[model samples]
Target: MQTLPPMLNLNDLRFFVMAVTHGGFAAAGRALGVPKSTVSKRVAELEQALQARLLYRSSRSFTLTDAGRDFYEHARASLIEAEAAQEAVQRRVAEPSGTVRITASVPTAQQYLAVHLPALARAYPRLHVQLEVSDRMVDLVQEGFDIAVRSHFAPLPDSGLVQRPLAVEAIVLVAAPSYLAARGVPAAPGHLTGHDGLLTGVAAGTWRLSGPDGARMEVAPVPRMTVNESVVLLGAAMAGLGIVPLPQELCRAAVASGQLVRVLPDWTAGSVTTTLLMPARRGQLPGVRATVDFLVNCLQPAEPAGSAGQ
Candidate 1:
């Protein structure tokens, strides 16, 4: 019988892949929450096992050799398949008792998902949850995340993953009572141009509003400040800085507390759909299913009254 090649170390392969993908040993170490020396050592061991000089390292940079480039393509694919296999087996378990990792934008995690997690824990005491909050779109399978929550104004692109609608998010214009008292309230969408605006995302200076009867208008306001995070914009608006468009659910507490007031009550800035996404293979996993069900149950659609514009 022919003898097989020496068994490769899976951990070493993982470190090697991570180092290449992340650009350096230090970066891979930070991502893995390990020491830079550990990452370097692991990759060295992988090279020794394969009997190949995979990387050319200098004081300033490292580049993959021809052999290393060829190996990386296969190694990355193998890692993805291995993770898929692990998830497939985990899905066969009947109880939701292991760790389930989830990713969502920072504001969504803090304002919506975080509040409901305690109830989830109460329902499934044995399930451990790992929540990662970020603004970037993460590759769910590559990142080993069980689920992702995303918000988009238009239909999301077809990603081949299973998606479920969580809520229809209404975008509404808001301002602190102090701001309106000082600058005068805007009675029509056209009047928004004269107001100081606090803006976010790509639509910093522009807003599209739709009335209840489906009449639409676009207005461009001169922004006093621009920020990327909704929570920060909300804070600025509440501090009497400027009028801002925000997701209704994110500012509900402030509106209820009378810290912020709706502007142009007859028109909505726009609407977005909040969605829960997961790899199709993980749909049958007990932990994944449980988390999906929990979110669907907990996150009810925003009441018209709660949104700044009715």
Candidate 2:
């Protein structure tokens, strides 16, 4: 008789979920409250039983392979439903316990995530967040990241990963009063040629705007004093370098303090977005769903008037 390999036990399922989730063994063990070696051993056993390479590993980190992703897509939902069913009948209400791997940039973390997130952590003590901050794009499924965020002006790739609109971010042209006094404010978009330009070479050119009448108006590009990455665009604008298009969150305090002036209030560029991208498999899991929902709620645009960008 052709002997079958050992059945995938519940312990294997738990570890498999953990490894793919945390993006590495160390995080998985931390969440599972077990030794790191234990997590590694169980996943290795699970891989052996399944007769497939579940993850691609290296000394620094590990990520899921294609077959692992497929298996995860199917198994995660099953596990969540099974766990939820058991929890419904059990006296001990189990709080959501799992790992959520995230890819973000320093700007997003400092400006938005700092104040908006963390409520989720307090709500689910067992939930673990592994954040990788970089300005570059990330492969959601390959890296095993539960959620990835970016404020990109470029077109997103046609990956099968699940994506949701986190927020419709708008960039407003702002200048400090000191700058306006020194260089004088341009009355119209074309007059920007006379002003000192703070260019964030990240996306060069004149900022585009949609006016009250829904007409497309093109503002002339400003010749920059300093050309570099857009990461510090807000700081340059605050130092009165020149008028720059900044996310509302970045210029709020300056606007409130009357240190900076919002130019062309009727204009905003819809080209930018604060989006949430996640692996389709992880999106199916209960803890992943809960975290995304919570973030969406936090990113909600205020009704009419909202808080300033800090």
Winner by TM-score: 1
Taking the candidates one at a time, how many backbone clashes does each contain?
A: 0, 1
User: Over the stretch 1-310, how does candidate 2's per-residue lDDT look in tens digits?
Assistant: 9997666787787888987888788899999999999999998998888899988898976878899999887778778987898887562334556788888887777766777668888877778877788877777767778898876655567788777767656677788888888877677766766676676564556556665656666665557655554547777777878888777776778899987898767666444567788877788776788788888888873331212221
Clash pairs of candidate 2?
Answer: 249-309
Tens-place lDDT per residue, model 1, 1-310, is 9999988887788999999999999999999999999999999989988999999987797999999999999889989999999897776565577889999998878877889998899988879999999989999999999899988767789999998888887788899999999999998999999999888855557887788666888888777998988889999999999999888889889999999999997788777678899998887888889989899888765533222221
lDDT of 1: 0.86
Cα lDDT, model 2, residue 175:
88
In Å, residue 62's CA in model 1 sits off its true spot by: 87
